[model samples]
Target: MSSHRRVWYPYVSPFDPCPPIKAKAYSTPPSLFLGYQPPNLEQFTPMEALKIGTLWKVFYDPWYSPYEVSTEEDQS
Candidate 1:
C-alpha cells in the first residue's frame, strides 16, 4: 500500500490538458548588440544582408565628421 494519496485525472488523448501559454511582450525595442546577426532577415534575405557584416553602415559625412579621430586609438 502506497503512503501517498494521488488524485489521477482520467487520461484524455490527443488534446493537451496543460495550462494555456501566453505570448511574450517586448518591454523594450530590439537593439543591435555587438556581433549580433539578424537571424530573421537571414530566412528572408541572406545574400543582400551579407554585404554588411557586424560593421555599422555610414552613408555620408563620416570622414569629415567631428567624431573622426586620426590616431589609431583615442582615450578621450
Candidate 2:
C-alpha cells in the first residue's frame, strides 16, 4: 500500500476573472557612515600654528601677510 495520497484542485475556465494583487511600501535606512564632511582649508595654517606653537616660527614669512591687499600704486 502507498502511504502518499493524491490531491485534486478545481480547474478554472479561460473566462474566469483574475485576482487582485496587493502592493507593499518599503524604506531605506540613512547612510551615516558613508556621508562625508569637507575640511575647511582656510583654517588649516592657523590651526597648525596653535598645535605646533613656537615651532611654526621657523616657517613664518614676514613679507607674505595674507591680510594685506595690494593697491594699484603698490602693484606699480
lDDT of each: 0.32, 0.36
5-49: candidate 1 lDDT, tens digit per residue: 123345445567885433322222123222364443323234533
Q: Which candidate is the best by lDDT?
A: 2
TM-scores for all candidates: the values are 0.16, 0.17
Q: Could you tell me how far off, in angstroms, the CA of residue 52 lies in candidate 1 after the best superposition?
A: 13
* CA lDDT for candidate 1: 0.32
Q: How well does model 2 score by local distance difference test? A: 0.36
User: Which window of ten consecutive residues has the lowest lDDT sum in model 1?
Assistant: 56-65
Error of 2 at 75 (Å): 96
- Structure candidate 1, residue pairs in collision: none
Which residue runs of candidate 2 sit more than 4 Å off their true CA positions?
19-76
On TM-score, the candidate that comes out on top is 2
Cα lDDT of model 2 by residue, 1-76, tens digit: 1111123345656666875233322222222222553444223366677775422333332232234542422655
